[model samples]
Target: MLFSESIRIAVTALLSNKLRSILTMLGIIIGVGAVIVMISIGMGVRQNVTNSIASLGSNMIIVTPGSTNQGGVRSAAGSSQKLKLDDADAIKKKIKNIDYVAPTVNSSYQIVNGNMNWNSSVYGVTPEYLNIRDLTVSSGSFVTQSDLNSRNRVAVIGTTVATNLFDAANPVGKNIRINNQPYKVIGVLESKGQSSMGTDQDDMVLIPLTTAQERLLGITYIKSINIQVSSADKIDMVQQQIEELLRQRHHLVGDKEDDFTVRNLTSLMETMTSTTTMLTLFLGSIAAISLLVGGIGIMNIMMVSVTERTREIGIRKALGATFRNIMMQFLIESIVIGVIGGLLGIACGISISLIISKFTQFNTVLTAAPTIISFAFSVGIGLFFGIYPARKAARLDPIEALRYE
Candidate 1:
């Protein structure tokens, strides 16, 4: 028989038992949809992370005090006061690719302005901190070098702090008391909603580093140093140069660990992206198990079909239908079922991803790769699982099949 005739017969068989065909495709539908949703969410998270990090600054690097081992107990990074203002100054002066270096000291205090009182984070930093952090002053001016030199009690408030303390009024030139020390508000920073870690980025206050050290915290050491390199391609070279410079300055010998840690955002981003990709693959694998189960359903139904059509197979064989023709008919039927299921699954998966994105906080991104892979895989499953049943049908002896009741 011709291939067209076989396909017509296969499609007719499926159309006659529409409900059973639909039921058999259920596994593929669910599996494909689940995989798409899972992968979309994973990709979305990775993209969000990348965007958040990029928004901080271009080619940014951070230096913090390293861990210290004391009596077999290791302290966390930044627990030591080894990172000082001198260290930040040295990096700024020595590093070749460095654009801006801002030493930071942080404290949490209750801020009061007239009748309003709000608790917020206070960061002590230099004028370069604004450029390093990609922050802009919406009103007034940032803390100047003169402020640091004179130890002036001046402050720059983030949007959240401004709103909480001054309401609709302009916060510039207002006095806000931090830890009972009155500091004049010099600027209000532009709003930055939140960081990738979910921390409120616009809830802090900025002041001169000297003021924070001498007047507020009474500590000479800084929390961390934020550095922006001139270009991303030169970050590795700059990081290495900074490390060696710090090691020499700290007087570290052979095999002796340095007192500070230097980290580049590029490496951090790559690590995070790899972790998320692995998670996406794992989720996709788990969802594929259902597709396998669906393939088994198709095979089982085909086996039962062979048994029901035993006498019909005998008649066709006796009428000169070749074994290849018999096999092709069954195989085409399974493939048809798979193709239809795959199309429906793609539609269902896209709709589900969109719905989840709209209704929840999760970000979902639907791309063409997953959809194409899923559809192709579903069809391949049909061919793989259909083989055994098709071969069994084709191998039936005409005389024995005709004897069945």
Candidate 2:
């Protein structure tokens, strides 16, 4: 028989038992939908991570004090107070590829502006800190070199602090108290929603390094140093030079680890991306298991279909229907079920993904690749599972089939 004629016959037989056909295709529908949703979730998470890392800064490197080991006990990283302000100055004077370096120390404090008060992070920073952190002044100016040199009690506030302390009033030139000492607000930084680490960026205060060290915290060591490379290509070289120079300055000899940690944000981002990609593939693979289960369901139903139509098959054989024709007819029926189920599954997956994204914190991203792969996989499943049943039906003996009622 012609392929078109076989297809027409197969579709007609399936339509005659609409409910059964639908029930048989339920597995495929659920499997495809699940795969799509799972893959979308994985892709969305990966994208979020990438965006978060990008938001930190471009071509940035962070240096922090390393662990302290004394009397056979080693403390955690950043626990030691080995990083000095001189170290920051030395790196700046020596490093050629470095664009800006900002040495900083921070602590949380309750800020009071009249009766309105809020607890916020306070940082000791220089004018260069603004450029390294990509911070912009919405009003007034950032801490100047003169402010740092003279240890002036000037402050720059974030949007969160500004709103909580001053409300609708402009924060510039306003006086705010930190650690019970009055500080004049010199600038208000533009809002930076959140960091990759999930901390609110716009909830801190900035003061000159000299003022914070002498008048507030009263400590000599710095907590960390932030370095921005002049260009992307120079990040590795700059990081290496900084490490080597720091090691020499700290007087670390052979086999002795340095007392500081230098981190490259670019490398950190690449590592994060690789990890997320692996996670996405793993999720996709897990969801694909349902497709295999759905295929098995198709095979079982097709076998039952062949058994129920034994007498009809005998009649067709008696009427000069070739073995290939019988096999093709049954196979086409299975394929139709698969194709229809797959289309429905695609719709189901997309609708559910959209709903989850809208109603929940999860942001799902749908791509054409997963949808296409799922449909094709479902069709392939139908063909692979239908083969044995179609062959069994085509091989039945006409004489015996007719006598068996």
Candidate 3:
């Protein structure tokens, strides 16, 4: 029989048992859909992480106080008071290829504007903080040098803080009390959304370093310093220079550990992206197992089909059908089932990904590569699993098959 005839015969046979064919294809459909959905979710998570890190701005580096060792008990990073305003100033004055350096002292305070009160993160920083963070004032202006120089009681609020404090009214030029120490609101920052670590980036307030130290936190030491390098290539070099400078300033000997840590945000982005990619692969692998199960189902159903059609196979062989023709018929049936399942699975997977992204916090990205790969793999699965049953049908003795039942 011709190959086209074999396909016609195979399709006819599947159509004759429509319910069974549909049932057999169910596994493949579910397996393909699951794999696509899982991969899309993984890719989405990776993308979200990358975007969040990129949102921190280009060539950003953070310097925080390092651990302290006392009686062999070491403290966490930022436990020491080594990161100070002087460190930030020195970095700005001495470091080459540096754009901005902003020393920050962090504390939490209850902010009050008449009857409305909200607790927010208070950051004591200089005018350079806005530049280092890539933040802009939507209205009014950011903290000025004069504000820092004279320790003026002025504050800049983030979008979240602004909305919570003043509702729809403009917050700039208004006075809001910070820890009951009245401060003038100088500016409102644009929305920054959330950080990679899930912290609300737009729920804080900015104030002058001197004012925070003198009035609120009552500390001369800063929590961290934000540094923006001029170019991406200069991040490592600048980080090394900052470490060396801090070491010299802090008077660290050869054996003594430094009292500060410098973090490269670019390096962090690479690490996190790599991690998420691996996780995506792992999830894809797990989902692929379902394809194997689906293939096994196809094999099992094909075997049963071969047995039920043994007399038909015998009749075909007796009428001059070649063993290759007989095998091709069953093989085509299996491939058809797989191809149909794969196509349906693609639709289901994409739909599921869309639903997940729309309804949940999980980010989902559906791309062509995974869908194509899954479909191709499903076709391969059909070819691999169909072989044994097709060969069995082809190898049967015509006389014995006819005489059996």
Candidate 4:
């Protein structure tokens, strides 16, 4: 028979058993859909985390005061001593890679103006802090060096803070009391979207670090330092230099541990990427298990099909159909089942992945590659399941098959 005739026969056979074909393909559809959905979610999560890190500025290094310990092991950075304002100046002057270093002090207080008192966090830092964080002032200038030197009680406030506190009033030059200490509003930072750290960027206040330290918090100890590296390539070298500088300044012996730790930009990105990829693979693998089960379902159905068509196979063979022709007929039937299932699986998978993307926090993005890959696998599953049944049919003795009522 012509190859086209064989295909037509195979298709006709499967169409006659619609319910069985659909049921057999069900596994493949669900498996492929789930794989796409889960993997897309994973990719989205990675993108979200990376964006969050990028928002903080890749060239920036955050120096926290306390050592973060894991289990019972204690790890420290530059100095065991509290980070101070003096350290910021030392880093700026000593380290060549360091473009600018700013010290920060934080306070939570009730800010009041014109019957509008909003309770929020207030940070005190130098003018350079705005540039380093890529923050902008819309209406007024940032608190200047003169402001820090004179210990002026001027402040820069966020948009939300401005709305809540000043309302329609021009906030610049207006005084607001923070922690019962009066401060002059010098500038307002344009709204920065919420950080990955979950802090609303537009809900805080900024002041000169010296003023905040001496007047409000009443503590000279700085909480953290923000260091800016001049170039991306210089991060590792600069980190090493900063670590060494801190170690020597803190009087650490050659064999002794340093109190400070220096972190780099790429490390943060790498950590986030690896973490996201692993989670995606883990989820995708779990989802792929269902595909295997679906394959088995296809195989079971094909076996049943072979048995049901025993008489027909015998009749064909007796009518001068060769063994190879019979085998091809059965094999084509199986491949058709697989190809159909694979196509349907791809469609179902894309729909599910898109639904997940629309409703979830993940940046679930679907690519053609995974779709094509998964569809191809579905076809493979059909052949894999169809093989045994086809072999059994081909090997059947025509007399015996004809006798199988």
Model 3 scores a C-alpha lDDT of 0.90
Give all candidate RMSDs, comma-separated.
2.0, 2.1, 1.6, 2.8
Q: What does the lDDT read for residue 137 in candidate 1?
A: 86
Q: Taking the tens digit of each residue's C-alpha lDDT, what string does model 3 give over 1-405?
A: 777887888889889999999888888999899999999989998998998888767899989996767678888988898788888899999999998888888888899999999999999998888877789889988888898889999999999989988999999889999988899998999987887546899999999998998888888899888899999998999999999999999999798887888889999999999999999999999999999999999999999999999899899899988888888999999999899989998999999999998898777999999999999999999989999999999999999888768
Clashing pairs in 1: none
lDDT of each: 0.89, 0.91, 0.90, 0.81
In model 2, residue pairs whose N, Cα or C atoms come closer than 3 Å (at least 3 residues apart or on different chains), thus clashing, are: none
Off by over 4 Å in 2: 68-74, 195-198
Sorting all predicted structures by lDDT, with the top scorer first, yields: 2, 3, 1, 4
Off by over 4 Å in 1: 1-5
Candidate 4 per-residue lDDT, tens place, 1-405, comes to: 788998999999988989988888788888888888888777777877887878767587776554535366675543344567776778889889777787788868999885789998999899888878889998888988999899998999999899898776779988999987788898888988677545587998999999998888888778778888888888888878777777777787777754555666578889879999999899889988988899898778878888898999888888888878887887788788778877787888787777776775445778777777777887888788778888888888899889988
Give the Cα-based TM-score of candidate 4 against the true structure. 0.90
What's the lDDT for residue 76 in model 1?
84
Candidate 4 colliding pairs, count:
8
TM-score attained by model 3: 0.96
lDDT of 3 at 218: 85
Flag regions of model 3 displaced more than 4 Å. Answer: 194-199
Best-to-worst ranking by TM-score: 3, 1, 2, 4
